[model samples]
Target: MAPENQPTTGPSTFIGENYHIWVIKIKAYLKALNLWEVIELGEPVVQPLRVNATLNEIKKYDELVTRSPRALTCRHSSLTNVMFTRIMTCEIAKKAWDKLKEEFEGTSRVKSVRFLALKREFELLKMKDSDSVKEYSSKLMENVNQIRILGETFPDQKVVEKILISLPDKFE
Candidate 1:
């Protein structure tokens, strides 16, 4: 088979921060390249070719084997050297991804604490008289996005309601 082309741009290197955003970007990147399954679902399991195996069997096996390394390579290239050191021994992308998630994502308690803080911020956010609607909305959404990074599915309807209530009386 011919060599495949890769995208010109990819996710930001993981440098011990913004794990959520990096994961989101990288997942999308991998999905676009049809490489996310190996990372998400782990490597594919295939049987060895039998003696006098058909050409199709060889091709299928080759593709499965090749994807494992390709996915691993994508993960390797996306990490900072310091981060890469943590996963240096990971020959599979799934293990590397899990290791990063377990380490940086913190424990459930830690995530809960963070989620609550962001939730409060989201709840208390109000537009100032001096701030434009766009600016105010942007700030509000930034907080929401951070909450999502924490793994909550913050509702779009709720954000819309908040935006409506946050507007100054002059706009009403």
Candidate 2:
């Protein structure tokens, strides 16, 4: 029987808008299922000379092959039909993950462009008159997180300073 905490259904479909969030969620799901290593490092190559191997070694190899296909199935089940089709040829979970990353996360040049745009958004972020302090903080944090994920580092003090500067005069 499955554990009470284990999800019986797969994660939501990914249509490409929030790849970062989707990746994080899917990774957590895979990790929970003990399938993340296969998606990251890939399946191990089996030795043909294993005919002389010990029984325990053979059992371990069998376990690996069994896990690989299950991981592949998990990967396919989590994606949309179109996205799944793109990675259907992938025999291993890692290959399918890499293909999805390359397609949705973009190349280095594209990432650089995205980083610059996110930076601009961060710079322009200001607490609107209608927004509460919590709402403003949430918006700021989201931009900060996206910037960090794109490989830009902002010191905590710098983020605090940005938040302070963005506040309305009432907070002064």
Residues 1-172 of candidate 1 have per-residue lDDT tens digits of: 4246656676568888878888889988888778899998999997888999899899988998888788888888899899999998999889988898889888889999999999999899999999999999999999999898888999999999999998999899
Error of 1 at 83 (Å): 1.4
Backbone clashes in candidate 1 total 0
Compute the lDDT for candidate 2: 0.84
Q: What lDDT, from 0 to 1, does candidate 1 have?
A: 0.88
RMSD of 2: 2.8
Which residue pairs come into collision in candidate 2? Answer: none
Per-prediction TM-score to the true structure, in the order listed:
0.84, 0.80
Best by TM-score: 1
lDDT of 2 at 76: 87
Q: Candidate 2: where is the Cα deviation over 4 Å?
A: 3-9, 48-55, 128-130, 151-156
Taken over the whole model, the C-alpha lDDT of each candidate is 0.88, 0.84
Error at 145, model 2, angstroms? 2.6
